[model samples]
Target: MKKIVALVTLAILIFSCSNKKQGNMLVQGQIKGLKKGTLYLQKMNDTVLVSIDSVKLLGDDTFLLSDNVKDPVMYYLTFDGNTTEKRIMFFGEEGTITINDKIEQFGFNPEVTGSKNQDIIKEFKKIDARFKNQRLDFIKQDFEARKVNDEDKIKQLEDDYKRMMRKRFLFTAQFAKNNADTEAAPYLALTELFDANVRLLDTINNSLTPKVKASDYGKRLQKFINEVKANETK
Candidate 1:
């Protein structure tokens, strides 16, 4: 009976080891102050978010999740399958990526590392925030001008707004073209320049490196450009 029990235990261990998840990319992180929760590593699958791997924490805050990354793409780290809120979004690629955040803050601000695309995104956000503030200021000015019925002021504000928008669009297109070798190039063009002229979008798309053009975001950018062009012809 003792020998049989030992054999059964060994078999269970072997089975568990064999079933362990292995992949090219590893996402490991620690959520400080978290005692218990479930962490899920998710990615988009044909417009649907799907979990690739998950870990349940019983008395610890450390977690490990991984997936077979074919190309650099955006990924989400969420708790308890609740991706709708308090989720950390990062660019995922081959190799190990480390993310560290406080459970109290969660996704508000996470320190993500090991992805070059993410670095570019961080850089762009800083400048983009300035543009956002300027836009808000313009909105307030426009509202005041219209309230006072100042036609000359309103017309000047309108012209200024148009120029600001043009500047923003040109900045975005140039930024994308500057980093055409990275997957983030197409992503930026798709997200930031989507409403811009088709010519600007085409310029950014045509500047993408071959490797980047083959990435997930690259394909999406191309498809979006085609759709816009088709609409113009209609």
Candidate 2:
């Protein structure tokens, strides 16, 4: 009887171990167009993309990615084979990765069939937007801190950013909402400083001194402005 019990226990252990494997599924599909003709499904904010995993693309545009996904995580579909575009992050589901449109739409398209986890995905998107603004405010704050020469205050602001960046999208966005006014002050100050900097830059751009005419400093200032404008989100 004891030997039979041991065999049963061993079988259960083997089955449990198999079920507890490291990964979940990743469903991939390509709607319209071709070339590489592949799209990637991956967990959001995660480093590596699962290439060797089993992903299915069906005739009706439904797909499944199966691995033992660790937990419910923020995941997005990326078209990295051609260009750098990431679909919105949604709470991952093993059921399906749906794409309605035949071709990829780089920007957010509300009508597009997204993850099986619809509500969670929408919430993730909302938080993502809010977090973006929160960080933008931080940029402005940086300029202000420098202009006022407030080293201590700058450190505090920097520390806050450090802490915030460590959090997930939802938490960070919620935190931003709660401390909206308090957080925005630094960014506003920075924006003012950047404006002043730009003014100085403009005034000096058209007229170069004997020393200025000798080098590319004027052009460099203009380049800096252009770069900043390009990178600044909204």
Candidate 3:
């Protein structure tokens, strides 16, 4: 009887180990103050957001999740599969990543590490925030000028706004060029240069390294450029 019980225990242990998911990327994190909840690791599949891995916490704030990452791409850490809000976005690649954040601020700002692509994005956002502020200033000035019926001020603001936009485009293009070897370069082009001039888009795309040009964002950027050029010819 004892032998049969031991055999059963061994079989259960083997079954549990086999059921555990193993992947190239490992994401482990701690959510302070989170005592009980479900955490989901998701990514965009074509256009749909799909959950690749998930963990439910009962009494601990720490969790571990992973996925088989083929290429570096943006992944979302959401609570209870909620993709609409409070989702922490990060670039995931082959390797272990660590994330730490408080439950209250959840997705507002999380310390993410272990991915070079993510570091590049963080650096870009710092400078991009300044441009965003300038844009808001221009919008406010335009609104006030319109309120006073100041046609001259409105025209001047319009010209200034156009110049600012041009400056921003150039900055983004140069930034992408500087990081041409990284996947972030193509990603920036796809997201930031969509409405930019075709020439600028082409410049960034051309600057991409062969490896980056083969990445997911790189392929998408190439396809987008092709579509734009095709439309221009029509």
Candidate 4:
């Protein structure tokens, strides 16, 4: 009889394990303060989990992230790349769970729903994309002028180039402040932008702007310096 009981217990354990889901999370919600943008659902452990197995987000204020969890773990919401004040998710139950919370992240009335933070992140992403697009066009044009060895025009680019970078730095700083209560998405975005644009601007100023290189590239660099400076004064 003991042997039979042991066999039954083993079978039950096996059955339960088999039924457990591997990718089993459905997080969804709406962020009322947003009009448009990309949002992220990033998980965190020792390091920030920017990328996850399931990439689920949409423009209609909905999202789903799936993963198996025997124990409850913490997840984050990335609104507009601001990660510090992210929405936290806890999965301690089996079936389905829901949550609703309003954040003072963006404004006094910014809200999140369904235990997920898809709403705020998406809206922020939209704004970030627009800002990037505006900057990219100028970057491309500045590069194009240099490709043909137009040494004269390089001086013109620098006036506001560095200043623009500083602006981006400042803008990202603001972003960091708005999302100050939760995860780390805003910080991550600010870090990346600082590297890509601000640091690059500094490098250009230090390495390429001065000493009057007088080459096509140099002319472009000068132009950026002038632009950055002019913008700064304004």
lDDT of 1 at 103: 91
State the lDDT of candidate 3 residue by residue for 1-234, as single tens digits.
Answer: 999999998788668646887799999989999999999999999999999988878788998889998879999999987788788999999999999999999999999999999999999999999989999999999999999999999999999999999999999999999999999998998888899999999999999989989989999999999999999999
lDDT per residue, candidate 2, 1-234, as tens digits? 999999998798658645644444444444454234344555533356444332323233433344555333445555543224545334454454455444555435623343443553354457667667878998899889989999998998899887656553235334323322231212222222244334333334333344332333233445665666676646
The candidates, ranked best first by TM-score, are 3, 1, 4, 2
State the displacement of the C-alpha of residue 55, model 1, in Å, after optimal TM-score superposition: 0.9
Best by lDDT: 3
Reference-based TM-score of each model: 0.89, 0.37, 0.92, 0.39
What ordering of candidates by lDDT runs from best to worst? 3, 1, 4, 2
| lDDT for 153 (candidate 4) | 61
> Which candidate leads the pack in TM-score?
3
Q: What is the lDDT of residue 176 in candidate 2?
A: 28
CA lDDT, candidate 4, residue 206 = 44
